[model samples]
Target: MTLKKLASRAITEIGAVLDSALPHQVEVMAAPILNAKRIALYGVGREGLMMKSLAMRLFHLGLDAHVVGDMTTPPLGTGDMLIVSAGPGEFSTVSGLIDVAKTAGAATMCVTATPDGTVPQSVTHVVHLEAQTMANDQEGATSVLPMGSLFEAVQFLFFEMVILHLRDQMGLSANAMRANHTNLE
Candidate 1:
């Protein structure tokens, strides 16, 4: 296949996944975030990179968002939230951190492909994003992208949409979000 063809296929696949998301799902993911006093996000591997991207955007929207394991991340407690990605549905580290956050009186939200997975089952809320992940990316996989790329790619777009929803919901202007961007960059 040509490079352009591959890119188009990938883009179309991502669009399908995003289209599958219900409006309620986006609201489910955003409501707790808006209610939280502090937000900590986590994921493993490439999914972690996506979570970090979301944290950055949330920060730019004037929210107190932090990535887990960051040096400056504050402790999560009452009125706080932990947003985690378990694309394949269960990561040991993700589960462990969720436990800790819940024990500390923080709400937890999980983004997952398998809503039935143990991690998702345990979380306070879940946003199900149906896409091919490492969990189901073996023989006969549906996505052209390898391993969890489909899930991760869909995550990037999904998170961006969530950010837009949040910005609008919070009555924030694009300029307002821009103002919160780091000057050091």
Candidate 2:
């Protein structure tokens, strides 16, 4: 296949995966971030990178968002939220953190390809992205991309859309968000 053909295929698959995500789920996920006194985010591998991107966006939005395991991350409890991604459904580390967050009285939200899976089923809220993750990315998978790339790519797009929704709902201007960006860079 030509490079152009491959790129088209990739884009089409991404759109299909993203289309499966429900708007109501996105609203529910964003609601906690808007109301939480503090928000902590986590994920493993490439998924973790996506969470960090979201953390940066939340900070630019003037929210108290932290990446879990970061040195400056504070303890989460009531009025706090822990947003995590475990796209195949559950990673042991993700599940452990969710257990701790729940016990600490923090609201837990999960973004996963398998909402019916054990870890997501345990969360307070979930935004299901029906993309191909490593768990199902073997023979016969629909995505032209390899492994969990589809899930990770859609995660970035989904989080960006969530940020847009959040900005509109909070009546925040782009300039205000830009003002919060690091000036040292």
Candidate 3:
């Protein structure tokens, strides 16, 4: 196949997979945070940055949300939600965080590319996206991109979509969210 054709095909496949996964993500993400006292999120590398964005949106939705290690994040208490993004589902740091989540008696959810992998069984919920390509560039002869790029892009896309869904589900106003934006920016 020509290089252009190969790249185009890769794009099509990734878009379709991410689109199909969106509904499942929206459906699952909504219910868990609805009644929680707060949502403490975790992820590592590129995935973790995406979680930060999601947490920011959650804060806009009038929920208490924070990145796991941030000073404002605080410890997860009973009736809280711990959300983590584990693209491969076996990251060492992710496993460690899940242990903390469980110990605190909080509900844990992992968004991963491997649902049946090690992290799935230990968590309360899983959003699985088995990606064929991701953003990590590497020196190889492969036509498609390297690991986790598509996954990371789609993770951000879907998380932004969740912001819209949360507004509808939880009755948040865009004006209110904007008001919450940092004035020091």
Best by TM-score: 1
Candidate 2 Cα outliers beyond 4 Å, as residue runs: none
Please list the residue runs of candidate 1 whose C-alpha ends up more than 4 Å from where it truly belongs after superposition.
none
56-156: candidate 2 lDDT, tens digit per residue: 99999999999999999999999999999999998999999999999999999999989998889999988888899999998789888889999999999
Measured against the true structure, the TM-scores of the candidates, in listed sequence, are 0.97, 0.97, 0.86
Provide the overall lDDT of each model, using Cα atoms, as 2-decimal numbers.
0.94, 0.92, 0.80
TM-score of 3: 0.86
Please list the residue runs of candidate 3 whose C-alpha ends up more than 4 Å from where it truly belongs after superposition: 1-11, 133-143
Model 1, residue pairs in steric clash: none
Clashing pairs in 3: 134-148, 134-149, 134-150, 135-148, 135-149
For lDDT, candidate 1 versus 3, the one ahead is 1
The order by descending lDDT is: 1, 2, 3
**Per-residue accuracy of model 3 over 1-185 as CA lDDT, tens digit each:** 79899789768767776778878777887788787898999888888899998998888888889898887668886999899888776778888989998899999998887787788768998877666434324554242645767677778877877788888887868898888787886
The best candidate by lDDT is 1
As for TM-score, the candidate ahead, 1 or 2, is 1
